[model samples]
Target: MSSSTATTAPPATTPTTITSPSPSSSSQQPKPKTKLKLKIRRAVAPADVAATTALINAAFRADDTTDVYLGAEHERISLATEESVLGSMTATDIAVFVGVVSKAAAVDYEGEELEHKEEEEEEIVGHFWLQKKSDTLAWLALLAVSVKGQGQGWGSQLVAHAEQVARDEWKAQRLEFDVVNTRSTLRRWYEKRGFVPTGRAKPFAYELHPDWEGVLRADLEFLYYGKDL
Candidate 1:
């Protein structure tokens, strides 16, 4: 199936807890604080194709124990290659956004860098594609976040950024996407972000991939979800 036809499952939501330090533990050493920054921007072809493709495949890898089955041996339900990413980048109606994460450096009072600086590190942790479907409608697809990046609200950030671009840049009045019907968790995640089911669905186009001979559930279908901008 084309990446546009499906979306990767959303990151699992985890609750946050806060605790106060006890007076008896005042002697404990303070741990170093590290802050991470996320930047979401339109991807550039060739330069971002490989990294974007790898991140998508890594994030979309299927879990046989939980995901709707494709086969025991197949680790991924959808895969993206450099060529495929480049193709999307070149499409006039499509725009791809990538989320990059890096450790934020602290500045001294004099506006100079700290001597104990951490090495410059960055990673492409998440990505999604937006396609202009009509003058007032756009489609979101291929949303994925790496395993390490999950549970940190990065996926939500990507979705929010995409919606802004769709509305401000594309002049779209609505945005929509399809999720596998079996993925109730993923659907609910989107619902929390203001998307609601459109009461529409279509059969998963497994027949399109002749090489995929794995057994699939007979009732698998893509459920439409949408939000008005």
Candidate 2:
């Protein structure tokens, strides 16, 4: 759950625009809006491992613009896999939740729409890990959302869901997580959500992968953030 490449917080949701047709147009057709339905629930083992792995990898590796500015060797890489996801799910203290999204059927749909039913298949768009560190503490980690779902607020929902579970269900007094030191924007996003710096940090666990020695930033560290329930 902890990694220098992990995205601790999600960026703000991008605003969606619904454009209207010009008043002078003969066929004044407005843009059709598709309503997306999101569902969050505990991830089932085996069934969710592959999808969750893909979601995490896609999200963590989505942005690499900083690599060019820093150096080619400073790129972040995601190493999530079905085996690792399944192994994590085996832990009794860790609970993973997945956010699934599907297109809502149109209210005025007719038989013609049935042909596109395949396109309506629900997709696993986001996921997060909530580990019960102790009776009064919980740790949040591995939060991620698919690139397609990034601007839709699914990530925030996942974090909120984790907080509620940790505070109410687990009766935890506080929640905490680690973010890469260089991710100032992400840290600020968490701060806006009531998390603050704990003035503690740990070296990135590069030993997890030998190849990461040269690929990841040599000075990378994880800065802690916490919130009281």
Candidate 3:
């Protein structure tokens, strides 16, 4: 299959528990279900910035799952504190490139609202903030889902949407992203979606990449996943 097409699938078809249930619900026998939908957009307007930031930050906190991506936090959620939130916003625009469907869109959403949505109604529960590094290469900078919508397959859809964006908008030949080499759980998820390891890694500069940190260590080379579009 072409890499572009391959990228349009979930890193894993089936979902599994990546993190322990929240402490507030620890006493409950089973977790309550959360309704989730994820829709991707090529355009994120300046008006949508704050809400987008909120969603992105919430998603980032939830993404501390299984330490699979080797981000800023370990053994706990990083975005809960103020420092991490500031860090994430600094590294990225948090508004322009990636975000979940805004409440405004979902509340009043109809067939005509988004022409793309009318064609493909994969409601956005999460988003992967992408950046074009070059004409031939693109960066999967951030992948996040809303805190309330964690279990309803938003992660997979966002990943799929990233590839679609690559094909539809960027026309990328290969979609590339970095993940911690030690993060087998997340890596497995990406593998199921068709990403393969390139065995390349270097120290991630937290100062430059504020959303992420040195937790992965410079010694921990990220495995590069490339899908030929």
Candidate 4:
């Protein structure tokens, strides 16, 4: 999710992966299971700036799964930076959220081979950027999860949490955002999360700014979506 539209247009559902040993094997193996526990909180500026930037870039940069929207044609997740993240956090209209997982959960859900601080209590796994539009509406941007943290329902949880905050805390009547018109998979992901197309489209507003160095394709546009909070 992001603010690429000249200060306009802001910015997923998934299956649960919780598993347990088969009934037949439960008695013998103590019921081996894998669970994902995440802690989401408002991001602290300055301290979380760099980690947030790295996580966003790692999750959104041109890659096999994300190329349709962000690949070489769109540069990369280059728009995120310490300065920008910190700015968003400090701005009254914006709120930044970060998702974290404990070391034990990382080992059980992900693998030891993944990069993380096993010695630490928890590690950053994902983040999102939100901008309030009005008393009844808000925009979401920069939604992302670390590469190692994807496919385990983190995205879904992030979206649900965002809506709760928008509704309960901000009193937003609806939560809104946009997706690149060409990214069907991503669109479907949002659709599964209950966001529907508003039959709206607009020129893609982001260009390669000096801070986010990279090449961008021409004539891009976005499709908008909204959900009543």
Candidate 5:
């Protein structure tokens, strides 16, 4: 789910909900109500760097669909190093948001168990970055959620938050992003979220710097997409 050139995703179906019977019904039937507890806020100081890096790597590694694309490009599961994560935090144009889930809603990532005390604390399960591209446009990059965090509607919530920040805080009229051209499933996922292909594309070569960890390959290219805020 990271357009940061690390991971891919399959198309996700919309969540289904069943309505409860009227509260006043005479039949002795009732349904319990519960609310999801998700906290979305700016990632904390330097401490967040390690957690974010680990989450992104875990998410991409557990997703086979993601590997199909990244592996072909000879890319590593991790797109960000601790240094890069911390570096982005200080940039004025980039904002990183981390989604912290309540313990009640937490699930073991990829079936990996945590000690009882560890499971009691809230977990940072998802993250994304918003870059102010220009006065009227913003771009979202490296959006990812841990393996167990997906399908819980948290991804959509993060996207919505990005759109709101672009419009309300940045005064931007549009939000843009790019995806590996080969990941049709991911493209369709964004399509459902109101993004449309813009007919613009760019090479996804990981040669942005000599120290970058992602491998450079000829098959990688990014296809651009955008949404009106």
Candidate 6:
């Protein structure tokens, strides 16, 4: 009797595969409403820089990250940040003019991080920056999505926004980005977004990142990527 009971309990204890609710029934469930509307604001003002930087920095860890961290502080802590990537003026003229006229060369800031100097309509949740690489070429300097807001297509929308600006506003013939060879989630993400490798390299960035925890071991191969603007 005891042996029979043990075998019966074993059979009853086996896990069952439950079927999921039907699509029509699942669709009837209440959907939670959200206040934040997902859209890319056309012009990012100077005031948006600080908030955006914090958002971008959140994508990194303390030890190792990527090329975007080069020539910058080790941590994302803004309290220790020496220079403002985002500017304090709505206009780059006053700030940029100072770079040109003062102790430092303005060209030195050509590839520097972004700074905002003026008020803006919407808070910048994510951003994509583009600069003229050539008369016909525009480089995507940065594309960062707020950590909490990622996986929601904000990054894609931002990329599309940048391409439109490059194509229509800048009238650029080509758009590109330098994925400083690192095995990163971002590297794959960019490829999924329609960018292809250009097989290029630059050796100077590693010296600036001697402490890189991520495998930025060499100045390494920068896989340049492009898509028609």
User: Which pairs clash inside model 4?
Assistant: 1-141, 1-142, 1-143, 2-141, 11-178
What is the C-alpha lDDT profile of model 5 across 25-95, one tens digit per residue? 12222221332446899986667879987876665545343323344335544455676666556566678
Give the clash count for each candidate: 0, 0, 9, 5, 0, 13
For candidate 6, the TM-score is: 0.56
What is candidate 3's lDDT per residue for 32-66, written digit by digit as tens? Answer: 34333554664344334455446555554454443
Error of 2 at 153 (Å): 1.0
Instruction: Give a tens-digit lDDT track for model 2, residues 55-92.
Output: 77766555444521145335666557676677556666
Prediction 2 global C-alpha lDDT: 0.63
Q: Candidate 2 — which pairs collide?
A: none
> Can you write out model 1's per-residue Cα lDDT over 1-229, one digit (the tens) per residue?
1233233222111000000011111122222243234688888745687888777765555333333555545544445667667767766667878888553321211333444546655567778888788999988888887655444566788889989999999899999888877766676778988999999977666566444346455566777889999
My TM-score estimates for the predictions, one after another, are: 0.74, 0.74, 0.57, 0.73, 0.72, 0.56
Q: Candidate 6 lDDT (Cα, whole model)? A: 0.43
Worst 10 residues of 2 by lDDT: 13-22
The runs of at least 3 residues in candidate 1 whose Cα sits more than 4 Å from the true structure, single-residue gaps closed, are 1-35, 62-64, 70-78, 103-121
CA lDDT, candidate 1, residue 178: 80
Find the 10 residues in a row with the least total lDDT in model 5: 13-22
- CA lDDT of every candidate: 0.63, 0.63, 0.49, 0.63, 0.62, 0.43
**What does candidate 4's lDDT look like per residue over 1-229, in tens digits?**
3343343222221101101101111112121245465789999746687888787666555344332333444544454556666667766678889998875566564333444554767677778767778778988777887666555677888888999999999999999877766666677778888999999977645543333334444444677899987
Q: Name every residue pair that clashes in candidate 1.
A: none
| Candidate 3 residue runs with Cα over 4 Å from true position | 1-37, 63-125, 206-221
Candidate 1 yields a Cα-based lDDT of 0.63
Q: Candidate 1: worst 10 consecutive residues by lDDT?
A: 14-23
Please state the error at residue 4 of candidate 4 in Å.
Answer: 18
Query: At residue 82, what lDDT does model 4 achieve?
Result: 67
Residue 224, candidate 2: how far off, in angstroms? 0.6
